[model samples]
Target: MQQTAYLPLALALAGMLLSGPVLAHSEQHAAQHSAAIVKEQKPWGIAGEPGQVSRTIEIGMSDQMRFSPDQLEVMQGETIRFVHRNQGKLLHEFVLGTQADLDAHAALMAKFPGMQHDEPYMAHVAPGQSGEIIWTFNRAGEFDFACLIAGHYQAGMVGRIRVLTN
Candidate 1:
């Protein structure tokens, strides 16, 4: 008798579910209005927008041997602000380059602890120190950034920058 009593309740549940999808179609009307607004707005700003330091890039290095962001991008002649913090026990340097240039510069920097690279966009932050490097991308290309500290680069303290064409 109890089992039979459940049959009507189950049938009501089935009917409700069958009609549930039809009720959901009404939501499509509200979503279409928002989609139209998105199609008209450019979140990244309009084309030909001026490139400047409307913000800064904050990065952190740690004692465990890591960089907050191992990759970056910039535009030609755009001033980028780097707020780098050395959260590590040792020193770190943000040196920019191509693989070949880094290899060559690394070799030359071997003689000196902090003086060998030619291309700019380099900064060395000591432990517990905060440093900054502001540079404008003058060319469009990919560049490698690495910490030239004694054995840090070998341990993989490197990143890349994709500077887009102006």
Candidate 2:
């Protein structure tokens, strides 16, 4: 009877310990899914088909708060592949949106530093790592790409993309 009583207590303790990580994983997964849904709904641009990529633009992110070729001009309805490489020794992200959207997102990021999420319009790159974002600029206007990592955006880590009429 002593062993039986201890068994329930031990199992309860194990469950408590295991549940923390499991719950955290679930929360992260949910946040990522939410982000994807929002991305799909918003009209920044549509996800580009891999077969429809018209050109590839390689961008490099660095510790100096900058992106190579910060200004991009694309024709409306053109699809482009953005290859992002993190050449810096810090975590960085390439998020594409309008200036207003980026500002709001950066504020949210500053408020919740631990927030974890991903979408097709965002590439979270670690130091010396690389990622890609393929997008179709069906809308004609100006968009932006920025590293909204707290102080990074304030430090001039921003790029512009202008979609021109074909």
Which candidate tops lDDT? 2
Candidate 2 residue 99 C-alpha distance from true site, Å = 0.6
Per-candidate Cα lDDT values, in order, are 0.65, 0.86
Question: Which runs of model 2 end up more than 4 angstroms from their true locations?
Answer: 1-41
- Residue 40 of model 2: what lDDT? 63
Q: TM-score of every model? A: 0.60, 0.78
Whole-structure CA lDDT of model 2: 0.86
lDDT of 2 by residue, 1-166 (tens): 7899899899999878856765675587677766643436355688787799999999999999999989999999898999999998999999999899999889877866666657778888999999998898889888899999999999999999999988
Model 1 ranges with Cα > 4 A deviation:
1-54, 111-120
Error of 2 at 145 (Å): 0.8
TM-score of 1: 0.60
Clashes per candidate, residues 3 or more apart or on different chains: 1, 0
Give the per-residue lDDT of model 1 (tens digit) for 1-166. Answer: 9999999999999878854543453354346434532222121121122255645788888776678898887775566777789998887877665688667656545634544322235677889998876555666777777877767777777887787876
